[model samples]
Target: MPRTSTAVIARAKGAPVELATIVVPDPGPGEAVVRVQACGVCHTDLHYREGGIGEDFPYLLGHEAAGVVEEVGPGVTDVAVDDYVVLNWRAVCGQCRACRRGRPWYCFATHNATQRMALADGDPQAGTELSPALGIGAFTEFTLVAAGQCTKVDPAAKPEVAGLLGCGVMAGLGAAINTGGVTRGDSVAVIGCGGVGAAAIAGARLAGANRIIAVDLDDRKLATAQELGATHTVNGRDQDVVAAVQALTDGHGADVVIDAVGRPETWQQAFYARDLAGIVVLVGVPTPEMRIPDIPLLDVFGRGGALKSSWYGDCLPSRDFPLLIDLYLQGRLPLEAFVTETIGIGDVEAAFAKMHGGDVLRSVVTL
Candidate 1:
């Protein structure tokens, strides 16, 4: 029997999302049906609502989810029924070129559930096909996803906090540890101290960065960054970010600078604020109209460092998800701090407002 679930949906561009009846089908081959426990309200969900991501309308909004696998399709041996799991967007195809090269994190072809969850309003028999946000549309009681999307984790971890590892938190941590390669005693400066940037700070601290500088326009966010293990904080509006970073690093500049803002100016700040032969990681998503102008060709040669953009923090869900969850279970990683508030599915629109206001690290939807 098809299951009817209350889901948040964006029917058209620039419109408010509404709670609607969504029909989720039974698990098909290579698929699974998860009883979603919690899903974080993320910027990507807002992007989908505004039609920034694609023209896929009637988008089922919500990712960054953790749930229990209620059913699994044939050939799904990795995850089993009744398993607590974190949902990930990147379910790497082992045959993809990137995976073939032993870099599954860079896998060009990630898989999602082959079948679509549909709106159950007009007809339960035939409903509108809805695009699941980031392939794991989870702001509902139940969601259909590729079996591989579900990464089984420790059952003891709280669903609300563990879900974050499925997205932003992982991206931020990966930016610092994987892309920026912040090592012991290295200096790291993270721009835009939002959830992701703050996570990057925590990742740097975990990696043993001596001077972890948090840079943001919001003092509240900077304060949160300090809680996450930042040794220094710089207000972008009050200080010259590059100079502040350099000053903190004894005028040598940070060893790595992460631009979590994804704007031209912030990227430039990241480019110039790093030490010679250092790394720069851009994890922020830029809009379509944004452009990088007047980048000096000479400086690219003179800087002699790597400038990289992180795709979901180049994370391998199978590897990083459990490890981070374990770290959270221990006293080391403070996953609970990331959850500013938890709301019902109907509160997604309001959550987006809070996100825009920069008031919360994450507003999770508890099913």
Candidate 2:
């Protein structure tokens, strides 16, 4: 049977998201229908609404989500009905080149529900087929997704907190742990103390890094970074980032420097603020038009280390999701802190304004 769900939808670019009824069909082969528990409001949703990601005008927003499997389609054995799960957009296809090469984290082909959720009749956007943002469109009561997209987790995990591991939170943690490979006793400096940067700091701390430096313009974010285990904080606007990072590390520079801000200038800072043969991780996203300028080509050769771009923190959902939740449950990872406030589905638009103003870590939509 088909179900009509109330979802936050963007009908056109720059338009306010509306509460609309979305028609979700019963799971088809290899798919599952999930009853959403909580969904986090993310900048990507705002990006979609602003036409920053694409012209998918009729966009069904919200991807960071956790839910329970209400029904499973034929041949779906990965998860069963009544299972508590965190939704992931990356359901890797086993046969892809990346997966076959043993780097499933870089899997080229990912899974999504084959059927589109249609806008219900009577709405102004009726008859429109929505493109679920990042293929999870979970800002609704019920969502249909590929069976593999649901990663089962501890039922005790709070839905509001667990949902974040589906996206930005995962991205940040992976940036430090998986991508940067922060190890015990290493010196790490994370530039940009937003959610992702703060998570990177947490990841570094979790890895036992002796000195974790956090750099951001906002004092509030720096404070949050300190709570997440940053040993030192740098207000980028008031300090010379490279010089301050070098001074903090006894003039040797940090062993690994992570750029959570995507701009070329910050990336340049990350490039220079590392010890010789040290790693530099770029996890922040940049606009298409932005490009790196004024960096000397010789510097790349003179300074030898891995320059990496962390796509979704190079995470393998099946392995990382459960482990992170377990760590969160053990009180090692402060997953709850990432959720700044809880709001209804309709509050997402206002949440976007807050995000734009750098006022909240995350404003979640509790179902």
Candidate 3:
């Protein structure tokens, strides 16, 4: 039977989010229903509200979430009822080329629930279909997702902290550890000290990088990066970004430079801020109008190292989430430091405002 759940929705582009009734149908084959405990307010949610993602007028906001699996549909074996889980957008299809080739993290065909949740009968927009942000639409009391989207983690970890692994934090950590390949004794420079950049710093530390240089325009974000394990800081506004990064690494440049800001300028900075034969990883999202940086062809040929873009940090949720939660439980990872504050569902709009002011890392919605 279909059930009603309260959710946050953006009815039109550039409009504020609204708390409304949504219909959450029973999990169909290969699906599951999650009772959300907490969801994080991310910049991507803001993008959805602004219609930056698409023309999909009604969007179900929120994706970074942790929850308990309340029900599983036929053929769903990945998670069971009452299991603590973190929801991910990419649910790899085992038969895809990437999966068969043993790189399921790059699975080209990800899955989402087939049935669309709609506005309930009372609303003027009743029966209107909602496009779930990133295909996991979680800013609701209960959410329906592909069964594979539920990655089981230790229940002992607080939902507010563990849920972060569902998106931005994972992107940052994976950008460093998985994509940038920051290893023992390597020097790393992460541009943009937002939530994702800070997580990259933490990841570099976790991966045993000797020096983690955090670059950002904001001092407050840099301070947060330091707390997350940055060994050095570079204020882009105060000095030459490339020169500063090079100086921190004793002249050559960092072994791995990450462009977490994702603009052409920052990407160019990342391109030039790496040691010869070093890696450059782009984790930040760029606008559709943005184009490739106008770097000399000679430079691209001369530098001779990998240039990569990280999509969701190239992560395999089933493999990464559990390990990360364990690390958090052991006190090795300071996941708690990322949470700036907790708010209720009604306070999402204010949380969005706080994000714009750069005063908070994450304003979590706790149910």
Candidate 4:
């Protein structure tokens, strides 16, 4: 039977999100229905509202989430009913080229529910289909997703904290550990110091990087970065970013520099803030209008190291989520620090306002 759920939706581009009654259908083959426990407010949700991601109106927002399996469709064995799980966007299809090559994380064809959640009867847009954000619309009391999207995690972890690993936090951590390849004695510099950048700092620390330098325009964010494992903080508003980063690294620059801002300016800073043969990882998302910086072609050839863009932090949820949760449970990772505040589903709009003012790392919606 189809059930009605109160959910957040973006009716049109740039329109404020509002609560609406949506119809969630029963899970079909390869699908599952999750009773969401907690979901985090992410900038991507804002992008969806602003039509930055697409012109898809009536989008079901919220992707970073955790929940229990309420129901599973036939042919599903990855998870069982009542199991606590973290929702992931990438439900790797084993037949994709990336998956066949033992790199499922880069899967070319991820999975989502075959059925669409619709506007409930009596609404003006009743029966209209909704495009789930990142294929995991989780802002509702219950959401339908592909069974593979649900990765079981320790039940002891707080939903607010564990849910973060579903997106931004995972992206940042993977950018450092997986993409940047930070290791013992390596010097790392992370530019941006927002939620993602701060997570990268924590990743660097966990990976045993010798010195972690955090760069940000906002002092408060930089301070937060320090608490998340940044050994030094650079206020980019007052200093030359490259010079400050190099100065902290004894003029050699960092062995690994991550740009969590995704702007061309920040990318250029990351490019120049690394030592010769050092790695530069771009984890920040750039808007469609943004173009690559025009640096001398000779410079690209001159740099002796790798330049890479990190997608979803290049993470494999099945492997990364459980390990990170274990670390968090053991008190080795400060996952709890990322939760700036918890808000009700109705408060997401206000949380977006706070995010713009740089007042919160993440405002989680507790169901």
Candidate 5:
């Protein structure tokens, strides 16, 4: 029998999300139904609510989630029912061109559950089919997803903390370790001391980066960044970010500068804040209207470094999730610190306000 679940839904653009009764179908071929235990409230959910993502009205919002597999479709051999798992949005299809070229991390085609969950009336009440946010909507008791989307991990870890590996936390950490290639003794600077930025600091520390500079406009966030292993903190509001970063790194600039605040000004700062042959990793999502302004052609050439945009931190969910969870379990990674509060599903709207105010790291929804 199909399960009835309560989910937060954005019925229209610029509107507050409401709790709705969604009907989740049983697992189909290549699909599974997970009983969601905990889901994190992320910025993407706010983006979807504001119609920044698409006109996919009635979007089922919530993605960073950990759950237990209640049922699995035929031919699903890797995971069994009752297995604790972290739900990943990127379920790589091995036959995609990226995967075929031995770069599964850049898998071009990710899979989602084929069947659609809908209102019980069976009519298209919302005028169109509701799109699941990031293909794994978890603001409910149960969610349907591709079998490959479930990454099994140690059940001993708390769901609220472990689930974060499925999204933002993973993105930030991987941005430093995998994308930026922060090496031992390298100087790293991360702009924007949000959850992602703080995670990047932690990742740099784990990767053995000697000098980690964290920049933020808010002093509270900078303090949090410092606690997360940043060797230095720069107040973007009061100081010149690029100059401060250079001053901290023997005036040669940091070896790598990560722009965790996706804006024209921050991107410009990141471009000039790194050393020659260094990397600038842009993990922050930019608005549609935001664009880079005029820059001297000579500056681009003289920089002589890679300016890379990291999508989900170029992370392979299957490979990175478990490793991060293990790191968290062993007390090396401070995943618990990311959770500012545990909220209920109805508190998503309030969580968005806190996120906008930059008052919380993450408000996890515990089901």
Candidate 6:
């Protein structure tokens, strides 16, 4: 039998989300039902609300979440009932080409629960079919997801803080450690000091990068970036970012420049603010209309390094989430600082406003 639960839903584009009764199906084969303990408000969730992601209206919002496994479907053995886990959107299919090549992080076919949950009553609802945001909608009291989407972690950590490892935090950290290949003694520059960018700074520090530079238009966020272990901060509004980065790196430019802002302007800045043969990582989510303008082909040739776009920070959820949680437990990674506030499910709409105003790093919803 389907369980009735309350969830925040994006009923239509440009409209505020509504808390409604949503039906959550029982775990099907290879699936599990998670009783959400905490979920973070991410920009991607906002994008889904604004219809920037898809026409899938009435989307069951929220993805970065930590919860206890309430039940598991057939063939599920990695996790059991009552196990504490961080819900991940990318459930890798071991048989995909990327997985076969030993790069499951780039798995083309990620998995989600096979069954669909509809409105409990017979009446059809308005707006599109309630699409699960990133395949792991955790805003509800209980959510159905592929068993592989659940990555078991330490229960001792606060769910509000641990849940973040599911998305933005993981993305930023992996961009630096996995995609940018930041190493000891390397100079790293991260453009955009939001949660994702800040996480990149922490990841750089964790990876032993000697110098970490954080760039942002907001001073408050830049200050937060500093607290998270950024050695240098650049106000993008007031300075020539490329020049400032070069100055900080002994005039050659940073070894790696990550564009966490996702705009063409920042992408160009990241492109120019790196040392010769240095990597450029674009981790920000870009609007559909944005495109790269005319640029000399020779510049690309002259750059002489990889220009890569990191998807979920090139993260292999199964491998990274648990290790990150352990690091958090060991006090090596400051995951607690990411949580600005914890609110109830009803506060998500207001939280979105705070997010838009750049007032907080993250407003987590505790179920």
Model 2, residue 253: distance off in Å is 1.4
Q: Is candidate 1 or candidate 3 better by TM-score?
A: 3
Candidate with best lDDT: 4
TM-score of each: 0.98, 0.99, 0.99, 0.99, 0.97, 0.98
For candidate 2, the 10 contiguous residues with the lowest summed lDDT are: 292-301
Error of 6 at 54 (Å): 0.0
Each candidate's lDDT (Cα)?
A: 0.93, 0.94, 0.94, 0.95, 0.91, 0.92
Over 62-177, each residue of candidate 2 has an lDDT whose tens digit, in order, gives 99999999999999998999999999999999999999999999999998999989999998768799999999999999999999899999999999999999998999999999
Model 3: lDDT of residue 293: 81
Task: Give the poorly placed runs of model 1, Cα more than 4 Å off.
Answer: 121-126
Clashing pairs in 6: none
RMSD of each: 1.3, 0.8, 0.7, 0.6, 1.4, 1.4
Clashing pairs for model 4 are none
- The ten-residue window of minimal lDDT in model 3 covers 50-59
TM-score of 6: 0.98
lDDT by residue for model 1 over 1-367, one digit each (tens)? 7799999999989999998898999999999999999999999899999999999888999999999999998899998999999999999999988999999999999999999999886644348999999999999999999998999999899999999998899999999999888899999999999989989999999999999999999999999999999999999898999999999998988999999989999999999899999898999999999998588899999989898999999999999999999998887999999999999989999999999999999999998
Give per-residue CA lDDT, model 6, range 1-367, as digits (tens).
7788888988889899888887887888899999999999999999999999998667899999999999999999999999999999899999989999999999999988898655556435822247899998889899999999999988988899999999999999999999999999999999999999999999999999999999999999999999999999999899999999999999999999999989999999998899999999999999989998566899999989889999999998888988999999999999999999999999999999999999999999999
Order of models, best lDDT first: 4, 3, 2, 1, 6, 5
- Candidate 1: minimum summed lDDT over ten consecutive residues — where? 119-128
Q: In candidate 6, residue 88 scores what lDDT?
A: 92
Q: Write the per-residue lDDT of candidate 5 for residues 120-226, one digit (tens) a residue.
A: 55445733456899998899999999999999999989999999988899989999999999999999999998988889999999999999999999999989998
Q: Report the C-alpha lDDT of model 3 over 123-185, residue by residue, as the tens digit.
A: 999999999999988999999999999999999999999999999999999999999888999
Which 10 consecutive residues of model 4 have the lowest summed lDDT?
A: 295-304
Better of 2 and 4 by TM-score: 4
